[model samples]
Target chain A: MTAPSRHALVPFVSVDNMMKLVLHIGVERMMTELAAEIEADFLRWPLFDKTPRVASHSEVGVIELMPTSDGETYGFKYVNGHPSNMKKGLQTVTAFGLLADVATGYPLMLSEMTLLTALRTAATSAMAAKWLAPKGTRVMAMIGNGAQAEFQALAFKAVCGIAEVRLYDIDPAATAKCARNLAGRGLNVVSCNSAEQAMEGAQIVTTCTADKQYATILTDNMVGSGVHINAVGGDCPGKTELHRDILLRSGIFVEYPPQTRIEGEIQQLEADHPVTELWQVIAGQAEGRSDARQITLFDSVGFAIEDFSALRYVHSRLKDSGLYQNLDMIADPDDPRDLFGMLLRAGAAQAA
Target chain B: MTAPSRHALVPFVSVDNMMKLVLHIGVERMMTELAAEIEADFLRWPLFDKTPRVASHSEVGVIELMPTSDGETYGFKYVNGHPSNMKKGLQTVTAFGLLADVATGYPLMLSEMTLLTALRTAATSAMAAKWLAPKGTRVMAMIGNGAQAEFQALAFKAVCGIAEVRLYDIDPAATAKCARNLAGRGLNVVSCNSAEQAMEGAQIVTTCTADKQYATILTDNMVGSGVHINAVGGDCPGKTELHRDILLRSGIFVEYPPQTRIEGEIQQLEADHPVTELWQVIAGQAEGRSDARQITLFDSVGFAIEDFSALRYVHSRLKDSGLYQNLDMIADPDDPRDLFGMLLRAGAAQAA
Candidate 1:
């Protein structure tokens, strides 16, 4: 048996290191790799221990813990969403996650998943669209123009080969900021005043708005046939973006049925409403878009397996990266039964 | 409105810092404060959200997330237990926890909970004993001389005014270590070979043996009437310390019914077996010790609110103590909608 060392430190990746690592790999290239990782995990979806997130909801916001394991490694993310937090100069959501060894239950890596969640959500959305959206789609109508707008644009560009993004938000300043950020990024970025204007000549319609109520950002008249809709913002209960009539006419695909029934756009439908599992399509057991007139919709609610895939991808890249710090997180004693002895030694060391 | 600064930082207390803080406050004093905090929270138990822990069980061990909130602050502990880990020279249980602001969903503190959990578990045990044990209880028979043995002795001394501790274990070296650790800690410590010898002339009996099977550490004939039992180690399924006949004769008080029914000693009983919630006792709504000769048992499976109280106590002590370091764990953007802008700036700074 190998002797256990006195130092049982876990590697920690802070927001700064995460940003540096992403820039080092280039954002688009990172998104591509993350998409591939997510796709690979989705292909073997039955191997995972899947559960919908455990959420603690209050009047103002909700905090959730999403956990999953693949018999080898376990991962969980702690994330919170408060819409009014943006008015208080805080990001609407913040997150952190850890990956642990299944044998010992010791945390292996602790990472800031705020940025990684954005990446994984976008990667998941684009991956779904690759199997659902029309072929050779070059234009995406972005209806949110907020924190996730640029990521959604880049993910589709890198994963689904989109060359143009038409952006619009209720707030003109948000559209200006998005247009300024995506300038000279090799895509035709157009700013529009109305959601209908952004949808003009668009083959992929992405509605990602920020609200806690059931107000329609997309109406039935705005959605055209033969286009794929990536509905991003309506993730939690009582929060949806599309009208009920629009959902009735489209073929909806979901990440997980039980969760989507409670938190996704399909929450508007009956609990037993039929929706195709995206993994089934990716695994070649189900069909994607069948004809030119079919309207496909991806009710994009994030799941634990996607976060596991992102953490797995990060762990694979963390090897020899020199981009992390050691966190003295675990108490390691010489004799495992002598935890008191370990504390006493620390007291003595301080005295010396 | 106060100007919202573009900075979001979380305080982190490492294992070293936790030891320093504990020593600074004195372990017994910290235990006393933690007991007080736990008692205070238990008094208002109906106001908090209570749920059984979210657990992921594997062949070797189990990892669990215990979460609770008091409407203002949210706390959760990530803990693991594996009995065979000690043979591999690793702790059988290790943990960490986070406390976050409920309004904005921002993490406020992250602390290593391996040592803190030890403190809180002992504190909770002693606190429960104060209400159930016979008056003027001065001698405690600690029947498992393991890592938790010393803490249990000290907590009883600090909280219940115990004057002597009798230690016993199957392994003589464990008993020796417990005796050595408690030599100058103001209480008299005695090492014994067997449980019967340890329980002689003792008013309180604490069985905390670390085994994963339903082994009898305490028998029916050995546990005399009028003695309170603090059962701490039988915290998982298929793990029990006292004989079923002994449990049948005792009045059991548990943390949470749904949890204690599965993990505590009461798992051997029928699903609707009569057990009282300890919070009801603390709240003066239920009976603790009905008479001096009645056998009272506190079946503690360790609830989430106890961990919350411990974290609350530590967070209060952390103010201006310089025992914690700031971790840049949250993403703070000048414009909450401009997360992409923040990443672009980071890239520019790295290139510059």
Candidate 2:
């Protein structure tokens, strides 16, 4: 009745504000923090209501709604992956997310999630590598140096203390762009001509190509023993990056089995292909790297809980950063039963 | 490489702007137009990708994501229902929605849907009543005079030429508030002390009480022959308004049977009980109001497509009304593969 109340105002983090926030707390430091946040959520995986993402797939792309709730707070992300979008100078994956209170069923925050998704995806990869990678891993072979390449490179340096990264892509310009961006970020950036060349001395190899087909970006011979394979880009049905033979030789670990079996690299294997749950490994309930010669694969298709963690992290940062704008998203009338009266008063105010 | 492009900016309709837009068009006229739009979408129901709403329920309330795509465009609404919210001076229901281009998977618009939802629910009820109500229906008996009551009253007046509305609520203050709001709206408003008194000579009866448990708002004896019942508030599992005998007497019509069977008033009836699809009736694929003596009921649980229609209607009106603000919601890089470079450039611009 007296305009919208404070409860009606949801904090919104725009793309501009998100970028400012990333810069305010340097990208590597933020990813390190995001990694810790994601790991903490992983520790309490059983408490979350993990709903498989509802996807609306068209011929060109897919739009998805991924939702999860941790009893007290609920969160969801609206994301789209359109490989064809790149040709039109649009991000292949663009996203936004919201967090709401479970008790009142009111939204708490709305944030642009494209950059945050990138950050969280990278943070998740580094966190998994922390559990599954060989000890003293120093170099990472980054194949398909697209938007996610630099983030993965930086996260490894921040979370796992990796000192160098070797980059390669089908598109050399992408590799060159990644190398240029990673120039002064303290990592030894090497632009390689071939995937094999990039993987020469690396202990971790990440494949993150953006095509929607089952194209093999890595083969069995290219991946050696003791290498942790962070397969980052095979995230939909019929879309995979590593050869089936490589998955056969590795100890596969995933965020969620039901989803990863259909969308991750394990889609190439049978339904019961025996992939370890990464959360169990992080919580010390299961073995990570059983030996130095074991090839541990973190089949990264992303999950709702990781996004929920990222949103929660951003919400926690908002009060200190003051980087969000108040959005009049919810309608709060003075008398909850008099919504129409509120509208009538609004009309009068406009007329005045 | 550069700043966000025009495509990155999505048009956002806040609650205040939504009120201004509604007032600009006038509530009755907007509901009339919205009814037509919803009817049009109902006619082409087969073209849509109908995904059941994903709901997260807590002890106190429930949050839901309802999504649908019409091949070319996709829309989703985030809504929450907390019956206990009113006791804390909060709305019992609140919502927001987004529309995206299916081809590129890019969001085109974001709008506060709390007000729009009330308008669409009313419009849908009136649209259904137009086909199922007795011919030349002139009076509507609104049983629950809460937030949704006034909208329902006005929609019936605008769409079905309802000349009078008899309003009644468990609490008299709600009825008083509703009566005051409808005073100068060109319809004869009557405040009734009981449910039976509200239905004195009305041909259309609308029940829209907000409670989480089953309650008998109307019985079979209270509903006379040829009355069209608009059941609005019984929209979740275990929540219903009409007596079981009343449902047995009425020819029930619904939105989506799979969903309505679980959430609508039909939840009180047998799972295999006969209920007509309202879209089929709108499309002439099924009969409506077969005979004057046969009672008709619209078990209105609401649907994603109805919300889709409302969003598309609002998007169409935005240009002429100019009541929206641009939100930097999507991330658009000069080169889609150079997202890192864009962030780097944003940092450089910030430093400059």
Candidate 3:
């Protein structure tokens, strides 16, 4: 048999390179592209393996690994949520992920998912809104103006054609920061005092609050008919956004039913409470937005498939930009039996 | 609040750095120190939050994430198994792990576990033997000698006081390689023709095969009373070393029962069959061996706690040597709300 030829090792995109690539690509264009990719992946949703994220929760917050595959490529995101981190001047959440070849079980790429996560999450929201939100929705109510607020505003502008964003946060400075960041981005930005003011006359309501408990950011009275609610932050078991009454009244949609049952707004309802998986609606396998006057809820808990799509998109983008560092993570032994040889070579090099 | 002092970014030990550190420390010393750490951790096993590892199996092999936590410290290992990788001059398994603080969910250290795994596996095997193997059990029958053979031989010498190793592999070159690697390491290493020949006059038999299928390397007839079998390679579904009859005839011990049920030699037996948890035995809650003539089998599937202990031990060593590089993996925004500010700073630095 011919000796096995060594294939070039896979390139890894470090956090520094990822940030540089994002800056070069322009965050808005990247968000728009990421949203398109998420939508495209959502359209072929059945082709992917899906599972609720495996989460390890502590008394403070949670750490989760979300994994999914499409029979060819496997992807997983490592993320942590520590709401109290903000008190300590850390982002409430941070993430990173890997994309690997299923054929060889080799990690093909690793990217910073912290910034990418914000972009993909907004993109996912935009993808859902394309099907679930009312046509020609121009105004959005954004609750909890934090790290994710800017991306959400821009994604709404690019994907759903939202021209106005009414932002509200308990901390007024956070709302001001969101508005200042979005200045000159061609959006009518309004800083509101409360969720009620933000939701007034808005076509879409988005709640991305970071508290690790059940906080009713949008009450039943605040939500209007013909509004699509993008509930982003109420993701762990005890954390929730909308009041249970609002979920009971609205037509609910989720990325994965099993995960949403325990983590999304629907977690408050019984296990049997019916909700439509967003993929079914995106694939035209189920209905979305039955009536313009009826409230619709896309209970977004963040799924593995979105990360898969995001990683694929980032890998492609990095390739086009020629931006990424090759991480020497995998050992490429000359002889499979000679792992010790690599160590010897490395040791000799260090000694020299 | 004083702007959250930039989060102390976690230090990452790349594969190259890890290899250099291992070579600098010397493998035998590292293995000895790792064995001590594993023993210490095993003794305090009840202080951990343990669970069966999460595995994703494909036709080629399996990828697993093994996570465990003490009340204060948490760690997890990401490893992949592909037996055919050796044919491509790649290691059958490659792994990396992280140690984090439970209080902040901040990863404190990241290290390549590919080499560390071999060291720790051998250390763990020797640790188990020290407690369960008969006193003065110097002659060890190492069946299916492969990449892990040299480490196992060295660890047996340092930890279990074994002076000789009888090695046998399906391929004679593997045994020769192991023998060559162990030359002048103070062990009387012998290459044997078959598993039966290797076990001859040996008090301990260790099966460390790589096949991803159930193959009985040892039968009841091949084993004698007073022999300790360290079963290491039968570590996934459909992979096993000993015959079911051998387990029935021997006093079986396992790392974690739930994991071993699906991955170890006991996988072939009925679920309700009684077996002693190694930790319980180590904690003195259960018996290890009733008599010198009793047969003891350590059906190890490689638990996460062992990896946690290994990571902690290696991190400590790396710190003492000052050998690890700090990875810019986590974003350290000065004004927690100013992640965008980091981009501006990077841009400004570039301009400067």
Candidate 4:
């Protein structure tokens, strides 16, 4: 059999290649670079065609398709959230994304986003912390040390110059695993007994627990004044990580208002409750942190543009890193109108 | 590198494998089987989660995502339509699709839909014709001789017993290419000079021209009584093939009215114009052909459920055919909560 044409092939970055890419570029540097790409896109957020993700919810889990375009390039991510999957020895969330040229609508690249999602989520959290965290913040109380815990810790160390990450999870094994993962990483990792102990002297607190419920991982008394809360866990309709009281007192900033009102921590608040758009803040159209003692919350419900940025970043690295395999995913006929003829020829070749 | 776990591997049927599968099963037989699968799905249509395709339109083309689920399995197709892409020596439409398990939210298979879509679209059209076409329909006039023309011809022959096909295209080379490809495929292929000549003795008139504007491929005078008009190419907003007068005279049947209203030939009619759901007809809940001489038009806009049916059909064939490769697309960790640890281990293995 003859090799497929270049037009028929799409560059695919598998999980192994993605890890190689990350380790080749170094996770911290890659996160910093990914954050820069995301920040640049956020700065021009109005140009994007943004819509709340299209989600299909079942009794067991939810599957979502998040698509966005900036007129020139279009991108979408297929992601699934199944909290029970972990018990079945499957990742709670797994994702993959595609980037296509707007002109021809041909896919430019396909990448495994399970690893990339963790990296981008942490990078986004750290990017928000760069704007909303208290000035001179040196420590981050990492609550809910699950799959995203170590990435979040490293992103803080790389992006926000945090010297330490205090880890805590309801399950002690989770906390211990997180501490072990971060042992050799350039950050002070602390395994704490409780959420309260994790927050001791911390100016930034990142909540990334993976419960598909409205259970509050942080209550009113647990939060301190002048702290920035990077809320990452409450991303679905009925799932919220912070308490309603915490939301009532904090000045919240979100990725997109319509989506955040439905999926973010602000879902607990009234529909019309005033909240700032994170893009506007990144673009200097709105304030991020006003006073040193004011509570600020970056309600992060991962958006399509962030995935687009990650896709763009990975595509940029493919030329130099050589970390992708081209799969014969598209059917390209030499004569555009002779698709049937192409099939006939392939059959003839096989017969020969 | 270590072999990825079963959880991480997604079975991918590339374009070559898809062609092999198609040829191995034989095109006519595959289309007949696909028609049966589509018919079975249509019979239980209301049980599926249905939605209009999510589309992103650009100046030269449009990119669309069509997603659907049947409570147990979820599927989606990523397709692009660029009418001008042909001038650039590219296929006017390219597609790929995925099928996933709703229970675990994990992808089960990914396949190139450029060929599968052609098969399914033709299968769907033929399936609709089975219920709506005049009894013992033999000759079909395929108006547009593009990439989809031969598929439609063979599917009609296999599904509806079309023994003769009269073909015509504005570009004579396309008609010639289609005729050459369909030469040995058990049908009397007639190359016609005009649309009127193509419909001379045809019982089913299929219009599938690929102009991205309001195109009258079949005018009122061109269509006759008792004919099953399978209008295929008037998909996407502002692109219609038949004249409104012809539409007013026909008993229209559609697959998903909400989408057909915007992207089908009925886009030229009133928003509240009466149209029968083809699924209802297939399920025996609605009438298909009321009289012998009545004009019955099956307005084919293509739906997510058709693609879902195709994915399901292709997935069923995988176990027996073994015409697929496992792609390391998902990141599966031993502990599920250790996605970051998986990355760390991969990195350490690389370093060693």
A best-first ranking of the candidates according to their TM-score comes to 4, 2, 1, 3
Question: What would the per-residue lDDT of candidate 4 be over residues B151-185, giving only the tens digit for each residue?
Answer: 99999999999999999999999999999999987
Clashing pairs in 3: none
Per-residue lDDT of candidate 1, residues B57-87 (tens digit) = 9999999999999999999999999888888
lDDT of 4 by residue, A1-352 (tens): 5678889999999999998999899989998999899999999999999988999889999999999999999999999999999889998899999999999989999999999999999999999899898889999999998999899999999999999999999999999999998897778888899999999999999999888898889999998899999999937989999999999999999998889899999888889999999889998999989899889999999999999999999999999999999999999999988888889999989999
Q: Name the candidate that leads on DockQ.
A: 4
Predict model 3's lDDT versus the native: 0.83
Q: What is the interface RMSD of each candidate, in Å?
A: 3.7, 1.5, 4.1, 0.7
lDDT of each: 0.90, 0.93, 0.83, 0.93
Off by over 4 Å in 1: A1-7, B1-6
TM-score, prediction 3:
0.96
Residue A285 of candidate 2: its Cα lDDT? 90
Which residue pairs does candidate 2 place in steric collision?
Answer: A1-A334
For candidate 4, chain B by itself scores a TM value of 0.99
